[model samples]
Target chain A: MEKFRANLMLCAGTGCVASGSAKVHAALRDEIKKRGLEDELKIVLTGCNGYCAEGPVMAVYPDEIFYQKLTVEDVPTLVEEHFLKGRPYQKLMFKEPEKKTAIPLMKDIPFFKHQVLRVLRNKGLIDPEKIEEYIARDGYLAAAKALTEMTSEDIIKVIKDSGVRGRGGAGFPTGMKWEFASKVKSDIKFMLCNGDEGDPGAFMDRSVMEADPHSVIEGMIIGAKAIGAHHGFIYVRAEYPLAVQRLQLAIDQATEAGLLGKNILDTGFDFVLEIYLGAGAFVCGEETALMRSIEGKRGMPRPRPPFPAVKGLWDKPSVLNNVETLAQISPIILNGAGWYRSLGTEKSAGTKVFALTGAISNVGLVEVPMGIPLRTIIYDIGGGPKKGRTFKAVQLGGPSGGCIPESLLDIPVTYEDIQATGAIVGSGGMVVMDDNTCMVGTAKFFLEFTADESCGKCVPCRVGTKILLDILTDITEGKGKESDIETLEDLARDILASSLCGLGQTAPNPILTTIKYFRDEYESHIVHKWCKAGVCRDLTTFWIDEKMCKACGACLRACPSKAIVGEKKVPHKIIQELCVNCRTCYDTCKFNSIRILPAGFEGDPYEFLGIGAAAATTGEKKGDA
Target chain B: MPRLTIEDLKKIKEKHRADFTLREGGYRAKVTVHMGTCGIAAGARNVMTALMDEITKANLTDVIITTSGCAGLCAREPLATVEIMDQPPVKYCDLNDDKMRVIFKEHIMGGTPVEKYGLVVGSETTY
Candidate 1:
């Protein structure tokens, strides 16, 4: 093996690649070759480093210096200054939003510090394309241990003791599910891996598959051994071309290395694996629907008196585990169940990977312990909401999940705790929302998704979600009735009660949760005909408060419709008839001078409510008065 | 790549031990080659190249090689520092390729500070 003094682990994950890591990679290679430093300094294109918002990012090992937002133009300065002169380039180092000092090390950055990497242990450290690098990190040792040393009963017992639940949203105990399938006598059992990650704003599974493809493969080998299966299939969505390509490469590498195919590790354990591409249907993420899709049928759920553990994937007893759940299996098998049980709560042991997106400052992937508070993940790890915005709520579990209000921010992230607040810790997609986001519109946005993805397999989820989406649309557009709230609640409950599979059952969670927590926002839209957040255009009317306006002409210049009329030293006025309600003027004003009133309001907003102008723009509900 | 037996897995792990040590970190010693303008002008690049060759030749993965700026001693020209885990750092001054190779053998591999080449025992406080 060739040795280099320093390794530059450059991120080439899908996020960083889209942000132009490829150009930077080419530039680095060209510069390194020109300088004759290729022998001394090696460049390794590793997977996601998780701080994706700062791509294209690179971490220089041995020194452990972290550089973010690299462009090809900056590469010359970086290689010359840091790689040659040994002085780190200050321009690319990560600077905190308010602080002037740049954070140099990856471990010092809060986004990377608070995370505990178990499933992502090899992320950004080893090259995903190289099997040698994976083996160097003790990759297949666990599978070797499981196959050669441990019996099927022993593997099942160790996993049951670990208390790891499925990470595909349902939180079912993986060991119990494996035990069920292992106990049932069958001729040929199938070990299936669910990689059909359909949730919006979620990429945990895609990253795991792309970054550490071998870990997933190694995990499947151990799982196949545990369930006494001889064949397996990994069902990935077609949208993830990079993940699919990398996983296929890994599968081919493992097979050639004799780690995957017949007589693996010379222990006479044989297991074959294949990759099955999903058509990007949202419902295929469900276990039964995924099994049907693998069997080459239209992806829809069937009633489960006979679960997949009994009659799955061609009427054979099979064990289907999520990509994340399978990724964690090898680590538990290698380190023992007690090692896996060290971090999380007794009931929900081990860490979970979350894709932090939406209105947060740090949009990336993170793995936190199971029992940590949501406030830590949001405020500490995610850097809170974007600048100058107050946190309103965080939507968890995609469409099947609910929004958690600020009051429940301190709740521990255990499955039970989050479920008690009407949200499941499903697949760890946390979309942080700010004060500018309207709760009614937020519910409507998720309903639009679930309504489109209800699969039409069951009436309650199909027709009931459509009816709920229509009512939410009405509420956001200022056409809602007094009885509409009750109607939405009653209908959401009916869908929750009589839906088949996990899709329709939890589809109404967003509507139900928003009505439970932000009921005042709902009433303000339905009765007062006002969207204080100014998000619902039909219910929103933007106005300039004459007393607060500075006569700066900032709003006048920003208005696309040329609705604002003002001169030097004169407060601006918005022509109601000419205004487009685009909120451009509201956002452009430096001073807090813009006020939102109910649609078609024709009087002075302060005088109509008999309140001070100062209190009017703070999103207070003055309509009840 | 052929089918790897369990023994082959261990061999591959041993071969890549240094790469992982640089990343995941359990290094026994750290060597910092000063690469300031003055140091580079005074054959510091030769010393650095020598150090890299010796580390690779010896297959010492637990010993990390890094570079730092000038140590504020331009008179010394080329300088290097070796700090084993839990020990005070030792700085060697006025180094060349031959002197660096000797230092790698006696001090880095043998774990003894070469008294003739050594200039300082600990780092100066910046604050």
Candidate 2:
């Protein structure tokens, strides 16, 4: 086999592709040909590189030069100087933020340093659409091994030994789930891959599906063989068009290659895989609801105890695992149980892929060992919060999970560790929060989401979520009575205990966790009728800081309510009655003079700004006098 | 052609193992415009089309163009990363027709990595 002297691996993942990686690829190819160096240098378009903030990204092999934010025009120079002349282009390299020096290799970056890529191992390494590239990396070998070498019981035993749990929120033992399905007497068992990821700010499953569709397919093949299931269904949400397209293409490719469909690997066992597109309902993420949707019924959960293992998917024994769960199976089988078990803590033995988003500087997909600390993920891997903002809290597990304060920054991230904090690792969606975030408002946002997503199948979820949202809305709007806190706690406890399914059972987590960590913020809202973050419009009063205001007409021109009325070069006075508190004037002000005060503050609005309980306790307001 | 079976795939893999040349950058340059929903919202498709038309007009054979999904930075779209063999790769932000041309003439052919326009500059050994 002929190997090129160098390989130029461009990030073709959705993030970099949008940043114009295709143009970069074309320009490089054109430049290489123009320079007559085509045979010596290669350009490989790979999947998501994971460092999404600095894309369209590419890494030159042999030298491993990492370039960020590329354009099509730069391709020729890169081709001429680097591929032909063998010179490193200094301008295209990545610069360290704290240090002024440019970094030469992709691995040297701090973001890539801390990540343990297990699930994301093949993400940036192969062409997802090409089956040959996947085969080259020993992709279907595990399926073949399971089909020919291992018995169904042996496959289940190996999986159980791997200690791999579900990456989906529950963290259920994957092998045990398979074992139940394998032992069931049904002649037609089913394997279901749950791609109905509904959590906000979460896209790890979608990325895996888009970047390495074959991995999920290979995993399903092994799973099907283990469970003695000849039929499989991938239940993906319709919202993820790209994941859907890629998954369908991958299924087609696998079927064409005889890796899927009847008599796979020339073994006697026959299996068929199909796709089931969901209508983008958050409730369908629940196993029962998802199964119902698959059965051409409204997506609603039925009571458990019979569970899916006993009677699932048209009343047949079925095994359902999330996209990430299935994706991990092939690797566990390929590497053996001990190899997989060696990485993480005792309970959660494997890496978890998180959609690291929100106030963090580098927002993208990240996979780390289960026991890694939150501090490491936030500070080291995430490049800290955006704009040097102080870390306040990190919300994990989406709306169904809870907010973890900075006090728990050192806490190891595992199923048990996170769950111990009253937060489940629900689908690995981690949204970082800054100091400016309003805990009450954040809780309210999640309450609203849960209220909208509740299937209304159970009265506790249907009615309780609505009441919770109403109370939260009232508190944020300064109409909340002090008794509302007790009411919220009461509702949270009842909802947790009585909700019909996982969606309702975990619906109050955001509220419960936020209230637990930042009860003071809720107290401030109720007692003082104030929004500490000035995010709640009803509790805030916008005024101009006379010292800082140049009386620039910017606020006057910007305010839709015509709230700011003052002559140029003079301090503007906001009409309290006419001021809709729309915050247009506050946003438009360049002088940083706009201020928001609690309802009772008479003068010097800045006194209320940034004054937490410490200032109140000290009885010494710096700017008050 | 018969549907490819696992045996056929194995045979193909074996056959390709000896003769297959992992072809280096010979075809015309390939431009992958991120047309993922987020990228399109960021205007990646227009930028991609501009680059495509430019390469076509220039009669560039070594280039192949394609599209990809989102790269996380919803705030910055129509972003493009450029790679040439010997030179360091450059990513241009807020790209328009003019910047694309400058990239085509200066970086693609002239062997110079553009400054100012790139988010990160110079190569590192870490990744």
Candidate 3:
């Protein structure tokens, strides 16, 4: 083989590719060739680096320098400065949001430092398209061990001892699931991988499938050996074209290398794997519904009496695992159950990967040991809320999960602890919200998604969610009655109890948790007809607080509707007829002068402008909203 | 291709150990060729290529080859630094492909600094 002095691991994951990593790759190749440094350095396009907020990222090995946000114009200078002169370029390195200095090393960056990469172990370290790179990292060694050295019972025992649960959301013990299927007498058993990650704002499984597809494959290989399964299917959604392509490539590579087909590792263990693309239905993420979908039926759930372990995917005994759960199996087999149990809590004995997004400063994917406090993941790893904003809540587990308030931020993030807060760490999508977000509108946002995605298999989910969405929309549009909150609560509880699958069962979580934590916002919308966050235009009256106004005319320039009437040294006022309620003035005001009042407040605007004075204190003078 | 046995997996791992060492960081010795504009202008690339060829020819996986910026001494172009585990770093200046080959054989392989080509025996101040 050939030897090179250094390796340039450029990120080619979906996020980076969307941010133009392909153009960056071409620029790098051209620059390296132009400088005659092509032979001395090797450029390898790897998977997600996890710092997606800083896309077009690259890590130069041997020196360990990390560069971010590389443009085509930067490629020539970067090649001359770093690649040729061997000096790490500081211009494109990651700079702390507050600090001016740049961080050069990827290990030293806080976002990468605090993460424990188990599921994402091969991410950004190897070329996802190369099986050799995967094997070089001891990728399939566990599959080899499970095939050649361990028996079917032994593999189950090790996984059971490791205490890893289903990372898909339910937190069911993986070993017990495998053991149940192993006990059933079936000549043709199935080992299925749930890659149908349907949660909005969640891409943890997609990253794993795209970055290290072989890890999932190797995990399935071990899982198949454990459960006596001769056939497997990875059911990924059709929306993830990159994940599908990489997974297909990885399967072909593994089969060609003789690690995947028949007689694997010369142990006579045969397992054939294939990919099944889902047509983007949210309910298909449910195991039973996923199995039904694979059987060429409409992806709907049946009540779990047989539980897929007894009857699944053509009615033979089967075992279905999440993409993340399978990615963790190889490491457990190679390093023993004790090693896997060393980092996390006793019950949730492993790390979980979270897709951090929304108003958070660092929008990326992070893997942290289970039981780490929600505060650390938010403040330390996420770098807190975006600048000029204060955190209100973090919506975990996507729409199937609930919003955790600031009061519970200190709680440890185990399966039980998060569940105690009325939130499951369901698929680990943490969307941070700032103070400007209206809680009622946020609840309505999630309700709209669930309402649209309800498969209509059962009456409760189909009818109840639509009713809930209608009530939320009415409240946001200033048509709320005092009794609507109680009605919403009752309907949400009924849907949660009577839903057929995981989708409907957990769809009401956002509404229930938001009402529990931010009921004051809901009441304000219903009775007072005011959205203090200025999100719902029908319930908001924009007013200028003259005491704090700077007369800067910034709002005048920013308002799209030409509603502001003011001159130099004069406080600006909105012409109510022309004001579009766009919240541009509220966001544009530098002096905190713009205040949201009750809808159609005709009383003295200055009366409630004082801090802590309620618009309702103006008494019967309130206009009809 | 034939199906691989357990031995083949181990063999492939060993074959790729040298390539992964650069990324995973477990090497007994490190050789940093100062490839600054001044160094590269004076044949530092030749010195680097020669050192890499020597390591591959000797089938050594424990030695790392890397590059860095200028060493603050442009007069001594084509500078190289050698640091073994738990030992002070040694700098060699004004080198060519032949001289790099000799340095690899005597200093890198033998674990002893070649005093003839040595400039300094310690690193610059960090703080």
Candidate 4:
């Protein structure tokens, strides 16, 4: 075969394709033909380039020139200048934000500089659909090493020395899990990939599978060889249609290449992989529950001691690892345990990918080495909070995780460091919050989600989550009692102690963390019956700020309750008695005239609701008022 | 077909005689277009098309083009980076059809990278 002189790699990942990468490909081919240089320059559409915020990205090989945000019209200039004359357009380069200078190479961007790509090393570099591109990059080299060079024991020892843990929540050591599965004396053994990532606003696994499906496949093959498992399953949520499709295609490609199926790398070890679609149940993320679903049963957690390592799917020894965790296997094997271990902190080796969303400037996927400060991710990588909003809190680990206040912003992110603050490094879902967010409302939302997703198998999770949601809901609605706070703490402890699985055990995290950090917000709700952020509709009453009200009938027209009563261009009076506190007038008032005051204040909703001193109050002495 | 053992894969790599230099000339031009969701939403598709069409129309096979995902400057969409051999690469923001044509003609094929539209200006080695 003739060697191609130059290679042009395009990010054909979903994000880029949706942004018109296909058209870019068409133009490149057309231009190459028009210039009669098609043979010299080879253009290949590859997988995702992790920095999704600046996508439609491409990299030129040998030189490694990185460019961002190109268009159709630029094709002619590209053909005229760079293609024929050997000159690149400086105007289309990537600009360094702080230095305000243009960066020519892909590696120079700070987003790429700080990251030590292990799982994502081949993502943006290879064509996911074509097996040859993957092979060209030494993709299946690790499985080759494991099958031909190392025994099952040797493979396990190498993994053990790597210090890698499950990227899925819980941080269980990967090699130890494999060792236990391998030791179990069972005829049937299974390897499962926990792709049922139900955490809200988290898509790290999806990105990996989409960009590098073969990595996960290669990882699983190695795991099966080590654990003596012949059958494997990738339990992906039904919601991720694209990931499922890509995974299936990858399986077919690997089979064709003899990388999977009967004789993988001619090692005499036979294995087959199947895809199981999860019906959007959050509990299935738990190990036992996930196993049950893979076995075509209702997804629910079962008792431990007879753990999955001993009796898993169909009462066989089984090992389960999340997509991100499995994706790390091949790289560790190929590069050596020490190379993988050298990047991250001592406890957590290798980089972690996070789906940074909500109130952040750069809201997309970020893969950073462990122990990097939260401040760097939030400010430097994420570009700080959106709209110049002051950073308030970052809710890590989803509903099963806790909120870390700004005071903890400087804390280095790792499994143990985050756990020190009572939050787990769950699937890397980091939701940024601003001061405008009401803590009580935020806690209530998480409780509602946990309550709804509970499997109802255990009494503590089913009943306790419901109770927690009710109390949090009451607090957000301004009916909270001081005793309610104590009751919440007590119930959280009870659930933690008695719940059947990790799901229930960590269900109370959001509420407990909010109470720990923002106890004052809860106090104001119980004693003062006021929502400081004015987000809780029931606790607020809208009144016209007489000085600010222009009464152009705008508020009157906008008010669903007809709470504003005044003529045009004149000062409007908000009828306190008629107001339902829906705040329609407040939302409609362009003049910013509407105001909400605490319960006992002159403009308070308590007077309008007619509760007036008859309402129950907790914490304060009865005669204090 | 026999089952491939780990040793077979190793032998294949050891005995591999394929050419390592698939592409020739260190003077090839590179263009990177940011196609993250936000960039796409801001009409990066058109910008990518313009660049490719111009390169094709000019019969410039040495010019390579590709797309990547978000660079975090969401406020500016349709971002592109251009690099010519032996020259600095530059990032351009808010690209449109007209600007793309000028960039393709004057920068990518003409040996001169447009400076005014550049968001970042530096050598490719630093990144």
**Model 2: residues with Cα > 4 Å off, grouped in runs:** A26-29, A543-580, A584-595, A604-625, B1-127
Candidate 1 regions exceeding 4 Å error are: A607-625
Which runs in model 3 stand beyond 4 Å of their true positions?
A: A612-625
Docking quality band of candidate 4, CAPRI definitions: incorrect
Give per-residue CA lDDT, model 4, range A1-625, as digits (tens): 1233346777777778778788988997898899776754668777777655666777766446776776677777765555443445565667865566778876676666666677786776666776555655577888888888889899999899999999998899999999999998888899999999999988889888888898999999999999999999999999888789889998987887688888776778888998999998999999999998877899999999798999998989999999999999997888788988887899988788888888877777888889899899888888888753588899999999999999998999999999988777899999998866888898888888999999999999999999999998888776788899999999999999999998899999998899899999899788877775667876665566666677688888887777777897779987777877776776677776666665434533333334336335333232210
For TM-score, candidate 1 versus 4, the one ahead is 1
Clashing pairs in 3: none
* TM-score versus the correct structure, for each prediction: 0.98, 0.80, 0.97, 0.76
Please list, in the order the candidates appear, how each scores on TM-score for chain B only.
Answer: 0.95, 0.64, 0.95, 0.72
Q: Tell me what TM-score chain B of candidate 2 gets against the true chain B.
A: 0.64
- How accurate locally is residue B107 in candidate 2, as Cα lDDT from 0 to 100? 69
RMSD to native for every prediction? 2.2, 11.6, 2.0, 9.9
Candidate 2, residues A1-625, lDDT tens digits: the string is 1324346778888788778888888887787788665654567777788888889888775455788888887777766455543456677888877776888776798888888887887776667777776776667878888888899899999899988898888999999999988888987889999999999999899889988899998888899988888999999999888788888998998887678888786787788999999999999999999999999999999999797988999999999998888888887887899999888988889899999999889888899998989899999889898764588999999999999999999999899889999888889999999976889999989989999999998888999999999999999888899899899999899989998899889999999999899999998788877676678887777778777789878998888888778887778989888888777887678787877677555543445465323322444443311
Q: Which TM-score value belongs to model 1? A: 0.98
Query: What TM value does model 4 have?
Result: 0.76
Candidate 4: tens digits of C-alpha lDDT, residues B6-111? 5555554433212122222333777877777777788876786677667656645466665666766888777888888778778888888778788888887686
Docking class of 1: medium
